[model samples]
Target: MATLLELREEPHWSYSALNTYLNMCSLKFAFQYVYKAESERTAASLPFGRAFHIAATHHAQSVMQGKRMTLPELHDVFAQWFKLECAACTNLTFKNGESINSLTEQARFMLDALLARWIDWNNIVSVAHAFKVQVPGLGKPLVGEYDMVIKDGETTSIVDWKTSAARWSEGKAGRDFQATAFSFAYLLEEDHGMIPLFRFDVVTKTKNPSLENHYTQRTKDDLYRFQLLALAVERAVKQEVFLPAETSFCCGDCQFASACKEWHRSSAAKHICMAA
Candidate 1:
């Protein structure tokens, strides 16, 4: 099957939706609080009212759906959607078994595509799903969410998912630092005990196999590149180096787009411009 980038050439969505997506990425990346460890990222402690904002968004999505579905429903039908079964859903359906048709069935499901990238059904002896590890000497640090913490007997790897119309193969620089941060959290906390292996997966959500859709797995060296890049960032953060990259991609979706674009890389990319 052809890759998604070569398939439709473009996936259609409202300008506002795309801009909102970009803005969410920017907000998390720019703010120090959201980047904090898992223990620090609760609904109550978020700075600049982001916690409230996130809660509200989920509430809004739930409101539209009429009710929440089970993990399987969320995983299969709408794991990647803004609604229960919208055509615009882009992420993976993780929960196994049959999907329930009803809208509101109580079950836990992580809604974020980037976070869901870590889930694996073929979990080996080394991989774990949603495992929590605490470091002994890391000053009570908050370990972030490791979507899939693989513990194949001896090797423990951190996995993450990326679900976008465009895959990471389209660009390597787009590797998320927040994802890397989650890996580090596990390393500092989880590795202190037994597992030492660490790997991140960027599974591009193409059409399903039976659906005649094909996707390319981004692994090995690709995942390592992000690991090293994020390492530098972690070091910089330790040194209080908070220099913003000032790129259009970072600021374009931001409320501060206009102010930041005065120095951004691409002037034209600063607005919520639709692509042809």
Candidate 2:
């Protein structure tokens, strides 16, 4: 198990970072390579997600260590973490008439649903486990933390917790690159020559919260495809080819939109001045 400090010292690529590069190269470059003048603000959903993960992992670890917490105790833990996070984050903005109280209630509902159905304490092998692995074609080591890993007899399973407004489709679970990467990382560590079942435990934040589970397994072919993708991303990053990909969906929510727009205006002005 690598310490957080040790992991930071090593060059590592994460699935989320790679996805950022694919989504918009300029934004990725700004975040990864360049230091921004100001710190990026957190989105409303981020703290909510973080608090839930903290509570879930805390419950899992405590149970594994022979200190089982009751559901109300778990809720108390969630509330404490959420309150701390909300207090620390200065730029949290609620959307569409969503207030802090409403979000807290939704979190409570989700927590109740999760405690009722998701956790099987006896089966969990590890929670929030960190790993770093080298893919054959990728330049940097791939690193990630598994939400939960379970060992049941001879079968191993990787469990990921998700909080969303809607349930993920079966097909999405089958094609998720992050889950596939987790499977590959696990296999690299274990060398068991067997694929582990990937499970996504989703909790929806609606008027009435609900829980859904989606399961899939990765094949050798999926790992090969990921290797190719990683190699392509490595090459692009090395070349410093950061191009802006403006889309209605991404541009609206992008934190670096203002930076990209400013860069474009300055570049246009430079071209005009040179021509004159």
Candidate 3:
């Protein structure tokens, strides 16, 4: 069992890296991971989600230790995280009509809504658990952190927290590649002999926030597909087949917009041969 820090000592893949390559844009992935390009701007949601996760981690850990944080106490935790993540950053881009104060208020409401939901913490196994697994066809190991792992009767669950602008569709979780990767990791690492449930506890950023629990599971076929995807991603990286996705939803606030523009100036082969 290698710690995430130890696993990060060498090259590896995570769900985020895979998602960026397969779903988002391959050119963006190359710019960020392969070329190590610096981001020109940061999305406001990045810090907001980080601050929210910090507070969520604190709350989950406190509850596991036999005490739950009061709403005021949780608010204080979020405030500190917000200040650290958002207040001091100059490159953060806010959406229309969004400001630091408004986002902070939204976080407060979101956290309140999270507290109002029913969270079963029966037999907390681990919080912020790090895992690494070697798939059959991939060269480097896959590494990721599980937000919460709990044992409920005969079942083990891996829970992740997410902040969304809108409610997720019912089947979003079932089709999520991250869930398949997580389930694969847990199956190999924990060896529970049963497929563990992967849950996304999502908090929405609305006038009145809402919490939705989306549960999804994976099978042997899903894990097989996950490995195949990883193998394909590795081959693409080796062959330098990165291509920009012009109509990607992430183009608005992309940090490497300038780099992407420069990439398009020359032919794809020319840029691929010489780093942009």
For all predictions, the C-alpha RMSD in Å is: 15.6, 3.5, 2.4
Which predicted model would earn the best TM-score? 3
lDDT of each: 0.34, 0.76, 0.86
Predicted candidate 1 versus true structure: per-residue lDDT over 1-276, tens digit per residue: 333224224332221222223434433343423233222212111111222123323433443355543335434433333232323222223233323222112112223332233233344332123333332322222223343344555555554433333344443423544433444444445335322344434332233211111222334454455445444444433443333445545343333333333423533233223221
Question: Lowest summed lDDT over 10 consecutive residues: which window, candidate 1?
Answer: 40-49
Candidate 3 wrong stretches, greater than 4 Å: 1-3, 87-90, 266-268, 271-276
Q: Each model's TM-score?
A: 0.37, 0.88, 0.93
lDDT of each residue in 144-170, candidate 3, tens digit only: 999888888878899999999999998
1 or 3: which has the higher lDDT?
3
Task: Note the clash tally of each candidate.
Answer: 20, 0, 0
List the candidate numbers ranked by lDDT, top first. 3, 2, 1
TM-score-wise, the better of 2 and 3 is 3
User: Which residue pairs in candidate 2 have backbone atoms (N, alpha carbon, C) closer than 3 angstroms, thus clashing?
Assistant: none
Q: Where's the lowest-lDDT run of ten residues in candidate 3?
A: 264-273
Judge candidate 2 at residue 202 and give its lDDT: 91
**Residue-by-residue lDDT tens digits, candidate 2, 1-276:** 885447857778887777667644645355545434342455678778888999988978887897877778888888888878888874676678887677877788888888788557688888888888887777788888888889889889999989997877669999888888888888877565677899899999887788888889999899887778778878866755556676635665555556667765665336545655
For candidate 3, the lDDT comes to 0.86
Please estimate how well model 2 matches the true structure, expressed as its whole-model Cα lDDT. Answer: 0.76
